[model samples]
Target: MLINELSKKTGLSIHTIRYYENLGMIKGLADEKVKSNNYKHYNNNTIERLEIIIEAREVGFTLAEIKKILTSWFETTESKPETLELFHAKIKEIDDKMRYFKQTKRLLEKVCEKIQNNE
Candidate 1:
């Protein structure tokens, strides 16, 4: 599919898709036979990759982190320790955030209880 079609399928704006392409996180190939226009074509793999990117972004992963994760999937020679360390750090961060959120929830509940009791 063309970039527009890919944008529609992925629910991402054309600029965001192009930004990802520019960042080397995704790519589209130009047809060799079609010389008149410079339209690029995307495949199912691109769609799957975009989906991963969307989910990762939603989970608070930086673009750089997402790129490295995707690269590690393709490049077996890449350093496993580095990727492992990144994941480990991310896990710690999320855990810390979860604890903080639980504390905040408790505080909020206490405030609500005080309000109800006119304290």
Candidate 2:
């Protein structure tokens, strides 16, 4: 389908989709048979890729990291050591962030209790 349909299907804005395209994360191909406008078409694979991209972003993956993961997972035959290392590092970062979040949550809870006590 066209970009508009792809946008509707992916729930992403046209600008964001274009940005991804520009970033080399996804690709849209123009129909060669048509001689008029260079309208780019997307397929089911594009939808699947966009879904992965959305999920990865939600999990705090940067675009570069997401692109690397996508390329490694989709375009390559075997998993690379670098990709494994990157994922391991990301896991460590997420663990550290989780601890920080827990600490912040506890601090907020204590502050709330103090406010309730008027202390």
Candidate 3:
């Protein structure tokens, strides 16, 4: 399919897809037979890649980090130590954030209880 279809399927804007392409996170190929325009065609693999990108971003991975993960996981023969290290670090970050989330939730609950008592 084309960029428009890819955008529809992925729920991302054309500009975002082009930006990912520019960042080398995903690629689209232009047809060799067509001589009129330089429209790029995307495949199913591109859809999977975009889905990964979207999920990774939702979990707070930067584009560069996502690129590294995709490259290491898909394009490489062996797992790189740095990639492993990066994942470990991300896990630690998430753990720390989880603690904060629990604290915030508790505080909100206490505030809600106080408000209920006063009313």
Candidate 4:
């Protein structure tokens, strides 16, 4: 399917799909004929990779990190364990950020309440 179809299927915007391609987060279409078109076509495999890439980004993986992971994944299927380890590390990082944000929110709420009460 074309980029538009892939975007619809992936629930990602067309610009974001292009951005991912530009950032090397995912590979472009393999066919030369398809490459001539302004928009690229994608297969099921590409779509699946895009899904994972998008989810990983949502969990705060930078484009550079995503590119590294994708490259390793494509090079060898054995990289699964390493990929999982990376994801676990990212999860821990996100959890730490969440904890900090919650604390900040609590502090802000206290300040707001104090200001409202003029105390």
All candidates: TM-score: 0.85, 0.85, 0.81, 0.72
lDDT of 3 by residue, 1-119 (tens): 99999999999999999999999989999999999999999999999999999999999888989999889877985768778988899999999999999999999999999999995
Ranking by lDDT: 3, 2, 1, 4
Q: After superposition, how far is residue 86 of candidate 4 from its true place, in Å?
A: 1.7
- For model 4, residues 56-80, the per-residue Cα lDDT tens digits are 7787898777876887787678878
- For residues 1-119, what per-residue lDDT tens digits would candidate 2 score against the true structure? 99999999999999999999999999999989999998999889999999999998998889999999889878995767778988899899999999999999999999999999999
Check candidate 2 and list the clashing pairs.
Answer: none
Pairs in steric clash, model 3: none
Q: After superposition, how far is residue 35 of candidate 1 from its true place, in Å?
A: 3.6
lDDT of 3: 0.94
Model 2, residue 21: what's the lDDT?
92
Quick one: best lDDT, which candidate?
3
Candidate of highest TM-score: 2
* lDDT-superior candidate, 1 or 3: 3
Q: CA RMSD for every model?
A: 1.9, 1.8, 2.4, 3.0
Q: What Cα-based lDDT does every candidate model obtain?
A: 0.91, 0.92, 0.94, 0.82
lDDT of 2: 0.92
Pairs clashing within candidate 1: none
Error of 4 at 52 (Å): 1.2
